[model samples]
Target: WVQKSLDVTFEEAVALRQAYLHRYGTTLGGLTAEHQVDVDDYLAFVHDIPIERYVRPNPRLAAMLSAIPLCKAVFTNATSEHAWRVLRALDVADRLEWVVGIREVDFNNKPRLEAYQRLLAFLHAQGPDCILVEDRVVNLRPGKRLGMTTVLVDATPEEEVDFAVGDVLEVGPLVARLLEAQND
Candidate 1:
């Protein structure tokens, strides 16, 4: 479905997808811009994953989120419906103020400067005041370039991160400590 939607041959799909990510930050974004693909149909087709099988309720995660004193929102390359499903599976739906998905930005995903700009505007936040926690170093690069505090989760080398953590559970305490240091 993705190859058909992107108008790429099966043999070329992988390379095409990679090139699209390199050029436009997301393959869907590239398809939307260059091929005029229908955003809704494409998203629905791509994100129809069996989320419940993978996601389990974690009370510790919920507790960690509650400990963070900042306004929280989810910025995802996936559709908002998918994000909602994942959050509900994790039992953290009520913790976020909003979920900004690729559909909201006309299929534009991370690593694009405009996408970040739109997200900051949506949150009524400045880049410096925001913290971006991502597992992919490529995704974190744009946020770091935009002056947001970038935390590389489960990543190696830690070359470009303001902080690195082996688990998402560490984020709340790290934020708290950073806040304390700022105040001091």
Candidate 2:
């Protein structure tokens, strides 16, 4: 689909995908910038998937999420519908307060200043008020620059990340610690 969408050969598509990802943070961002790609059409086409086949319901994750007192949201570069499906598959669709997708920020994907600004506005939040928990270090960099407490989900924490956890499940404890520190 990407090959046809970009009108490039298979190898060209792979290279372009990497280049776009490195340069624009998202291929869609580059596609729209360099090519006259229909954002809606492309997003819908790429996101069409049998999510249930890959993901199973995580009752433990759902329970952990529900136990948190503050409102939680899934902020992603992906489409909102895709996020919803994944959340539903995890049995945690009801746990989150909202899902902030690329469309929500008017197609401004993560690692973009506009994306973070838009998200902060939507949440009526200051950078310091939020905790950004992500698996990718690149994604956390911008949030850290904006004063967000960065929690790297993977064990290897970089300098930009404030905390490290082996898995997302461990994030609950780290978040609690942050809340306690803030109160003190």
* TM-score list, all predictions: 0.90, 0.95
**In model 1, where do residues sit more than 4 Å from their true spots?**
6-9
lDDT of 1 by residue, 1-184 (tens): 6677656688788887887788877878678767867777877787888999989999999999988898888999888889999999999988888899876765558878788888888788899999898888888888888899998888664878899988999999999999999999
Candidate lDDT values, in order: 0.85, 0.88
The clash number for model 1 is 0
lDDT minimum window of 10 residues, candidate 2: 152-161
Mind giving the per-residue lDDT tens digits that candidate 2 earns over 53-80?
Answer: 9999998898778767788988999998
Count clashing pairs, candidate 2: 0
Give the local distance difference test score of model 1.
0.85
Residue 40 displacement in candidate 2 (angstroms) = 0.8
